[model samples]
Target: MALCPISLSLPTLQYFYSEMRGVDQENEVNRILGAFKLNPYEQLGLRFDCDASALRRQYRRSSLMVHPDKCPHPRAKDAFEILGAALKHLEDPERKSNLDNALSFAKEELLKDWRKATKHDAGVRLAASLDARGMEGVEAAHVATPAFAEAWKARSREVLGRAEWRRRRMSKRIKEEEERGREEHRLEKQLNKNIVEHEKAWEKGRTERVGTWRDFVAKKAKKSKGGPVGGIKPPKRLRALLRCYQQLSKARLSLLVTATASAGYVAGSREQIDWVGLGWTTLGTFMAASCANTLNQVYEISNDALMKRTAARPLPSGRLSRPHALAFAAIAGVGGIWILAGKTNALAAELGAANIALYAGVYTPLKVLSVANTWVGAVVGAVPPLMGWAAAAGSLDLGALILALGVYFWQMPHFMALAWLWRADYAAGGYRMLSLVDPAGLRTARVAFRNSCYLFPLGLAAAWLGVTSPYFAYESGIVTGGLMLCAAKFVSSRSTANARLLLYSSLVYLPCFMLAFLAHRKPNDVDDRLELVMGHLRSLGLFRSGVDREDEGEEREEDQGRVAAGTSGSDGAQSIAPTPGASRPLPPLSPPILTGDFWAGPMVGGLPPRGAKS
Candidate 1:
């Protein structure tokens, strides 16, 4: 039977009551257990050797038996509370260690004191028996012998108890180390299993993700196949045709020609536009530009291969043969001039052919030979607008020249900036540019600035020549002044940044100034001629009845004075109100300029001189 801690001492019961007396009796058993003081393992009905789980199991059994509701004993609640506290104390490593230390110290002290008392008692008994058995004369000698025997017996028992305690401790330590090793091996196997499971999960997820990506690609390909390019492979001939077309066109630069041509057509024609003629002119210009561009590429293929900038072009990259390129150029060049001559006018056709000749024949070879190539290239670029103007009017005129000169001046800063940026490339390609030749950029900067200076006078000349309104003089002054300022900055700095500013200013000035000139063009001459015709018609009606037209005109001198006073400012006002009694009773509408006929009529054969013919 196990010795119960409670049964060992009646003082223990009293001590337990004393500890529990101050604690709240009305509290739950667990709370009471937390405050309770008792031997934890003993309260749980476990030996000190029991493991944590055994302690816990014994605690549960004891708690169930001593529970206040089930046992119905006065001490049952206390027992349950104590049992809960014991379980907690034993479960906590720190509290359990303190309890074990106290128990061990108490056991050690008790054993030491018992050894002293036993030695004293054994010495007294042995001495008394020795005194009874020995002769009276040997008492002193026997005294030391009995004492030594008792001390030896007491020391032997102490040594045996210490050896037993040490043996149990060593056994416990070995069992604990073996248990720890088994636990570590179990954990190692578990970790390996977990790692394998994680890898499997990762691979599965990766496979799913890859499958999803493949599905997306397949869906995209299917969708794309149903759309343009259609899944079917293009024929070799068709591919070659497309590749050749792209290489020959140089679409972006051709658009500039188309734009200037449109501007020129607007500036040249006073009557309604001829859309069919304009279309032919644009198409002709595009073909001319395309032909020139292809020829230039063909001629420069070897040089292009030397420059990084041009090395990837179709010709230099060997994507298209020279024979194919030459054939395309010949066909486009001849075809473009023929279209212009047949559909537009001889002057436009000649300008288109000249533009091609200058760009390909003169400018292309000139690039390698001389820096003057830039000037020739600018002249070439300026021809498109002239072509358009010629196409519209069937001849070159002041307006056409003005438009062309504006384009010519605009390219100076534009090309100079580009040349400065690509000077090294141009050097590698053996092209002579001002940027490369001057090195200091002084000449290039001066050229750009000088052209900007010329642009202002050119703009004013356009206004003075009656190509645009006087407002254009003022507006163009500001625009040109800004461009000149940018050029001046480039001249002073000779920096790429300043050059870029000048270049961008040129780009902005060209289109804006062209549009401004087009927007504010002088009102059609047809208006004044139409007014003269209307006046003549009114005079004819008076002539039919033999009325004196001269006297009627003289009578309206006072009315004319009043109208002139009202209209005589620099406002460009036109007066169409007839002198009083000069015509029929119909009130004059605004001048023929206001009527749509000034702008919307079919092309006039030619303007008749005033008073020359109806």
Candidate 2:
């Protein structure tokens, strides 16, 4: 008690103070790690309604106490980061406002419960308690009684629990929505990828598909020879005949030619169709087409051997000798010409001969020399229809010309698609096709699209020329429009898939277009049929015969007056009076007969039966 004080050096004092600071930091780190992490105010040990400056001051003091450089705690970095995050959250205006509102709501609910329990407002009690204690802080625990402090803590816990649940639910819902959007986007991308892969695979397997088709054809030919027929082996003679048949003709193409020839015959005839004559016409057309095809094979044998698609042909495969093929062509040509001349007419025979020569001589030779062979081939396809028209009507007319033009225009798109599809084969065969010359397929697709456009007008022309009804125009328009759309797709993207689509559409378009023409063909004997029906109706007393006779007499008088007036003209040409039983011309069939409002007889002023009431 009586000893003198000993002073320490300045560095020792500084070191002692550093040791105390380090201990305080370690303790602060432990407290920060132990605090509740969800609530910023709880994590920072601050009241809800603290001002921004006080929040910053408290955050800095807490951060220094838990600084990782000074603290010796294992979780010092984690604690420091947590403390910094808490400070940031409290500084946010929206976050601070929400916290303040939550705390006030919790205090209000506590006061209500207190009033119900003690029969007095907790606010008044809290104020009186605070005045008595003389507390300067805004914290409820600093001024409130112990009972109020416990109630406030319970209410705050309940409010914080509900708020945490709502926040988690909102976060989960947002994640679910985001996951659903990603799944939909992934599915759409996968679908697009699959489509592209399918198209690529289809194009890549084109040669394999062609080979398979050729194999199938060869197998069918073998079956026809001696393999099996309906599970029974064919006789040797029958097999020999089948082999000769295969060697002599391309069956599908010949049948198509015959069918087109028959269509032309049907379209041209204004009188009753001669079924016997049609049979002869089909036979002659088939022979003529076979002759052309056989001769073409004979000339292209070497080239055909070089190509995949044509290598399996009889001439190229050596299934038929050149001399035998030449002899077959000769026989077919002579036989076809003779039959046409004997059964039909000179014009039909002449057309048959010309087509054979054009196809075998012009088109076949031009195939290797120039791309104009396609046009020549189209002309060759066009001749059969003319031959049929000649066989039926014994002459060519506008209707015949229209039918031939249809065949001509149709061949362009049909052959262009086929040529583009087999461009590699054509190039290997040394044929100078449009597709071969235009490797990018630009001109080939352009040619196809342009020809498709021509088909629309050709349909309208048929209707305009009175060869078919207006219904045919509408029907053909739809069919050709579809073809045009396919061709346009090929033009835009020269893919094998699109080219194949155009080819299929062309195949369907031809048959449909021909059938529409036949279905809507304007009957030449409509007036005759109408007169015969009217005469029968008069015989049955449905119309008065005396009235019809009177009308005919008046018409004769008017005709005679016109003839007399004509004889008095400066040209002095006398007009003949109409015959007594001659039928009046029928009007064009514009509207469909299936409609309720259609009246065929009234269209040509033939209704009311001359004297019947309207």
lDDT of 2 by residue, 396-510 (tens): 8667888888889999999999999987667667777888657578899999999999888877877766778779989999999999999999999999999999999999999
In the predicted model 1, the residue pairs found to clash are: none
What is the lDDT of every predicted structure here?
0.72, 0.78
Candidate 1, TM-score vs. the true structure? 0.49
Best by lDDT: 2
Cα RMSD for candidates in order: 35.7, 22.3
Q: TM per model?
A: 0.49, 0.49
List where candidate 2 sits over 4 angstroms from the true fold: 1-234, 524-614
Q: Give the distance in Å from residue 379's predicted Cα in candidate 1 to where it truly belongs.
A: 1.2
